[model samples]
Target chain A: MSGLEGLYQQIILDHSKARHGDGPLEHAAAEHHEYNPTCGDELTMRIRLDDAGERIEELAWQGDGCSISMASASALVDLMAGRTLEEAGERIDAFRAMLRSQGAGEPDEELLEDAIAFHGVSKYVMRVKCAMLSWVALEACLTEARATRG
Target chain B: MEGMSSDTLGARRVADLRLDFPVFRDAGEHAPAYLDSAATSQRPARVLDAEREYLEHHLAPVHRGASAAVGRSTTLFEDARATVARFVGAGERELVWAENATDALNIVALGMADASAGLGGAEASRFALHPGDELVVVEAEHHANLIPWQRLAARTGAVLRPVRVDARGLWGPAELAAVLSPRTRVVAFAEVSNVTGFLAPVAELVALVRERSPEALVVLDACQSVPHRPSDLAASGVDFAAFSGHKMLGPNGIGGLYGRAELLDALPPARTGGSTITRVTLEHAEFLPAPHRFEAGTQPVSQVVALAEAARYLDELGMAEVARHESALAARMAEAVAELPGVRLIGPPPGEERAGLVSVVVDDVHAHDVGQYLDEAGVVVRVGHHCAQPLHRALGVTATTRASAHVYTTEDEVDRFIDALGGVRRFFGVAGAGEQTGVVA
Candidate 1:
């Protein structure tokens, strides 16, 4: 597949259209709002941590953005819904590293799952920001959620 | 270049002028069909070389020293100012140097803020606004024009009255008439809508402002119109106007603020320091008049020189021809793209007299995705709200993709853009690619 096809995989398009874990997390520990002024892509994410504050018990978000950003946000919730904060951080780092790699980094497909489709997006210097917008929000909200517990 | 229209004026001139720009020359196969000139124009060889020559030879501070080098540099700089002044139809003293068009508008707004606060004494009262007064601006204005007026209104106790735009993102003289009143202190607007390419009826608006609110000051954000057409700011009867150099084949970081001599002299200087003072004391200092007072600190001398060179180049080509070339190109582009399935043209309908720009919203495809698709097809365009969020909200689109043209634009480049835009919906799988939904003009 070409880079454009790889970037817009069937899974990404489906996730973008019918996003999972989207729209308002109730009794949430933390929430964050992020906007990309360049293209006006916006995302508001809410997190509900478990009683132990070790795992993200629930992750919900709402946003209006391009297919890349929407899909990335959807795939993020899918990857980290029940994972520990440390594991989520690792995944975020790996995703960021792959995006920064300029289409060169071999991301762990087992960890990234649907997000590995964005490896083609990494090739585009501009679209990397689109793919990473929600992940950045998640990182910030996660940090805030951890602080709220502490 | 099949389907290229032979009817457009200056089609041959565009072909000839294409060679002056270096970007088309260097990038052969990978050359982007540039259609984003309204955002920022690409400089020609003459403009670039002028700046290089100035930097290489005459690099000295203007208007400061007693040395011959300083005198020579000051002459070059002032000469540039004069050339630019003539280009925009203002007197030498009427024009002030600014960082860019945004800075120029800010100079006026901030200066007015100072005036409202009793800064320039009694002479500045002409600009002072009170709680009951209203600052008028149109919804379709670029943020460069709108935000400054908004801040001005906030700083003073004046109310902001926006003249509403239609669903097409256009406002007419009737809209302005509806908003005008005796309490209107300032009327600020763009001579051309950067996003929608609506050519504002300047003379009619000025006349209406004069008739209804005689005391109201008129400020024009001339960033779009000044570059593409022949403009006489003095004749237009606006109190102040701002436009950038880079949009007119000139160097960046240089722009002009044209204010009527009476208003400019009375208006308080927003930025102050060296080169602006007539007499200095520790507590109180007397300021120089108009352009000198506004131009604080060491100026962009090389940029000024290049900008003047750019103005001269444009003058040689004739602004009328440039305007005709770009308008025809935009009209052609509008007609071509408006026919595409699910594609919506944002400005005036095809064949309307617009100011060389075309903005569009594709159904079910975000503007970013459209821009990406165009980029992949080697067709560059501007994407986003284009710094006019309120207008975008009014138009019911979060963002739009704009394709604009300059003097150097060719029919082939516009064709490439139209063809690329035609394929966007199909590539994105937006549904009903071939099936027309009556979008054709």
Candidate 2:
């Protein structure tokens, strides 16, 4: 009923149209790749880190997908970049909860903007799988990045 | 809506009758108008009640047990066999129960495999296929018919030649007979095409096969046809016929193969286990006769009982009346769809030749989108290629929407479908009836 405006919003569409959240960061950093076969969404995500890999210097991602997933990746890249591991983990948990709508507490106010666009998907059960496939793939990529350091 | 006294066939066809099934009656919001009859048919109250009656009162193991339950069950089981055989115009002795229609068809295939493999003992000559021999089937065959013969040909080094349908979903007597020569050892086909509802002239084709190649064995996939029409398998000259209970208002996991007793005896069982064997030695096992030999495992008893009831329900309404009635309904449905702007009848035109259903492609709309939109309107039709990929490829379309009718189907339902179909293009913002929709979701 609301047309595509509410679903797309300004920030998400800009990110999708520009593909700004793309490519690996230059210099030493943690990197990951994601794949969602259901809707043909694929992303190679990269995050630059300080010497010890405890703090994020830059975060970027490249992928092709529907408007929602690509926008979420771009927003995540922008919001989580320059944040420490502890803060990034909290943010990730909050994003996952918002998508699930079942976690113990709400995510903080700042990083919740892009994630709100997807709440409409929960009503359509079939679309939920399509929307979550990318996020799950991103989590897998992040887990792989953390494992590589050990 | 049912019984002989009823003015019309109503929604009594095998697949359409499923809506009367209590299970389907539970579609609270969006009922699935199941058009996938070739896959299975839903059971109506008559068939279900028949099953319940048998289970509640006539419960027992048939053929061997001596208790009152056993006697009553055997009567019910034997009575089912007679009813199914009679429905297809075969003698009761000639009909043999298998697991399902696929199993029924496989019994023929494996037996042919055996004869081709020289496993039929003294009677092996009746079925043996040598190198350079031909096994003729049609391109419209479901994988159930195709794969088995393909495997059989592979095993025996025989050629599998198909009497293929053209772009319009039709294969006639002259075209089919053209492929039959001295080399053709067998001719197999469906009495009706599951995808297109293209009715084949079984009697004429089988007669040609007999004339052209006297030794050619004929097998019929009655899975689609039997549920919709009255089939006289023996009279049609096919040596064997297969039909499933699920497709004919019975339970799933059960079916039958009607074979002339002499022919059945010649065919060795494909599966061997407890019941089918007479005596077992360390060296070899002597198997029981046909039907039981082919059964091999504990048969689907409850389903078989249910199938027997389905046959009786069909009998209560005369088969000839059933056929004629559904023919009119199918024709009406097809004609209504054809009249819709830009609706392309994928199969034969109405009255050209058909069983009791139609498949069509609408211009400018993807079938999936069409199906989704129709679901909103509470009209359920089968979307996508109806499993005959080769046939669909031949017809030059990726998918088509099929709406089939049975006895329970009303003329009003047909009109509603046609009316809603006209709106499908406009609702989806599709341009025209002849224009194509590319990149379907």
Candidate 3:
């Protein structure tokens, strides 16, 4: 497949059309907003921390963006929804490293799941931010949730 | 037959002129169709040669010392200024060198900021803003023109009042007149919009502003107009105007600001340093006249030489002919866009007068996807909000796909763009039978 086709697999197209966790969290611990100024894509991501303040109880978000950004956000919900905050942080770092690897890093497919569809996106330097936008929001929301965990 | 004959002549001229640009020569067999000239134009061989010649042989500090080399360099530099001033129909002393159009705009805003902070004394009071004074700008302004005015409003406590754009992302003299009052002190707008390619009636608007708000100063963002059309700044009667070199087939990092002599001399220099002052003491210094007062440090000398060559090249070709060539291209693109199944034209209608650009929002497909599909098919276009977020918001779209033409653009390139744009919805699996999918609709 061409790189553009690979970047827009059937799985990505499906997730983008019917994204998971595409709404606001009523009982949220923190909400973070991120914007991609290059194309005007924006998202407001919300997270609910567990009572122990070490785990994410739920995660939800609402925003408008392109297919790649929307699909990546849907895949992030599957990869990071119920994990501990520390675990989510590690995965976010690994995803960022893979994106920066210039298509050289061999990510663990079992761990990333549908997020692996973004492998073709790493080759194009401009679209790397589209895949990373959701993860960056997750990190910021988690940090804010942890800080204000009263 | 008369129309056909002139069309043939214009097409032949474009074909003959293509040889002057080196990029076309280097890409002989498989040249990508370039349609993003509104963002920047390709430099001709003459412009490139002039810069290289200056740097390789005749390089020295300008307006600095008494050395023979300095004198020669200064003469070349000042002669370049004279050439550029004549091209834009401005006095030589009224033109100031800037880093780019963005810097040229910032020079005005920053100078006003200093004036508002009580820096330029009684002479600079012309630029100082009172708390309730209003600054008028259009919603379709590029960020380069918009953000500086926003900041100026913030610093001076003046209210920023934007003349609203229509559904087509356009505002006419009527809309601007509606916003003017006795409290309006400044009016800033672009001569042609970067996104929608909407050409403003500059002389008409200036005349209206003078009649209504006599105290207001008109600042023009001429980045789009200077590169594509015949422009005489003094004849237009704008108080100040800014344009860049890179957008007009010249070297980057060099642009010019044209101001009336009175304003340039009265406005304090925002950036203070060596080469700007006439005399300096341990605690005080006095600045030189208009252009010298604005040019604060070591200048882009080679770039100035190349930019002058670019201006001369355009002058030799004749601005009226250049305008005719690009306007025809624009009309062709607009007609093609109108005929497409799902593409929506953003500027004035198909045959209406516009600068040399066409922007559109494709139905059921994001502009990024459209851009990618066009790139795959060897067509280049600008895809984004194009740094006009408020305009996009007003148009009810996040971004748009823009195809802009310059002197080097050919008919075949415009055809490629239209063909590739027609395929965007189908390629993205969004083509439906006569269904409107744009959010605004």
Candidate 4:
């Protein structure tokens, strides 16, 4: 497949259009906003933790950006919902490592789920930031959630 | 090449003009249609050769030491200053070397801030601002022009009065006149807006400032204008103007700041150190006049030489013809892009005059997507708020995709940009027949 085609895979396009969990959360333990100044892409993420604060009850986001960012946010919402905070952190790390690898790192499909689609995004240095925007926000939200738990 | 007459260079076709730039030759068939000259222009062989020739043969510290090498270097540097000054319609003493246009503006602003704090003695007192004194800036100004005034206002206890732009991100002389008052100390604006390609009426605005705020000093952000159009800073009657070399087919790391000779002599140097001083003691130091007073550290000598060559290259081609060519390209891009179904053109409408650039926002698609799509088709363009976030906010779009032209840009390149842009919404599954078919389940 061509690079542009690979970067804009079918799954990524669908997720971007579907935009699951794309509104503000009414009750949330933590929220973080990430802005990509180079392109003016902005994403605001809100997370609601379970009463015990060990699991993510919901992950929601509101943003205006390109397909890569919107799709990444949508995939994050689907992949991290009901997962433990520790597991979410692990996924964030894996996603970040894979994107930073410039298409070198082997992504575990079992672990990454639909986010493996972003493996093609690693090849583009400029677009990598777009794909990683929501993941960065998730990491920040996780940090805020952990602090709130303590 | 310097011996070539203006008629020959001016009459050269766009294809012939493209040959002068080695970048196109090196890239061969793979060279993207370079439409982003508004950001930084590609240098021609003449400019590159000039810089290399200087470094290979005549490398020495300028304006320092009584050595023969120093004298030669100083002579070359001063001669470059004269060439560039004449290009911009300024006397040799009126121009100061700066890191880039941004630094050029900061020198003026910071110097004024110093003046406000009782520096540069009685002469600089003219620039000093009192409490309630106003600094007028336009909303559409690039951050480089706007932020310095913001800091200066904060430092000098001055009020920053912004002349607001319309929804198209354009402000006119009338809007400028509304903001002018006797209390206005400085008026800062761009000659051509980097984002919207709006060509400001400089002389009219300067006249308005004179009528309303006689004491106000007009500062022109000429980063966009000095490159693509005929410029006469002295005739425009502005007190100060700033522009970058890289934007004008010259080497990077060098720019020019044009100030009225008397004003530059009186304004305190923002940075103080070697080369700028005439004599120094533990008590106080005396500085040289005008250009020397502002050039504190070791200079970018080679870049200055190459910049002069770039000026000569443009002069050989004749700026009037250059402007005429680029303006036609801008109109072509604007008129075609305006016809694209789901695209909105920024700045002046199709028939009106603007600079040699066109900025557009695609409906249901971000500028990043549009830029990427254009890139895939080998069409290079600038995409973002373009360092004018406030202007973007005022225009109700986060970013825009801009296609700018220079002397070498051809009709084919503009068509490629427009053709690629037309496919953006469809490819992204936002609109058109392709929206339903291009996507996979």
Q: Which candidate leads in TM-score?
A: 4
lDDT of 1 by residue, B87-175 (tens): 99999999999988999999999999999999999999888988879999999888888888889888888999999999999988899
Candidate 3's residue-wise lDDT over A27-105, tens digit each? Answer: 8888889999999888888888787888888898898888888888998998887899888888888888878878887
DockQ result, candidate 1: 0.61
Candidate 3 stretches greater than 4 Å from native:
A49-57, A145-150, B1-12, B434-441
For candidate 3, the TM-score of chain A alone versus the native chain A is 0.93
RMSD of each: 2.8, 7.5, 3.1, 3.6
- Evaluated on CA atoms against the true complex, candidate 4 attains a DockQ of 0.66
Off by over 4 Å in 4: B1-9, B433-441
Which residue pairs clash in candidate 4? none
Native contacts recovered, each model? 0.55, 0.00, 0.52, 0.62
TM-score of each: 0.95, 0.74, 0.94, 0.96
Model 4 alpha-carbon miss at residue B48, Å: 1.0
DockQ of each candidate, alpha-carbon based: 0.61, 0.07, 0.59, 0.66
Alpha-carbon lDDT, every model: 0.87, 0.70, 0.87, 0.90
Evaluate model 1: give its lDDT.
Answer: 0.87
Ranking by lDDT: 4, 1, 3, 2
lDDT of 4 by residue, B1-441 (tens): 112222222679777788899988778766899999999999999999999999999999998889999898988899999999999999999999998999999999999999999999999899998889999999999999999999999998999999999988888988888889999999999999998889999988998999999999999999999988899998999999999999999989999999999999999998999989898999998889998999998999999999999999999888988888888888888888878888999999888898889999998888987888788788899999999999999999999999998988888788788878887887777886533222111
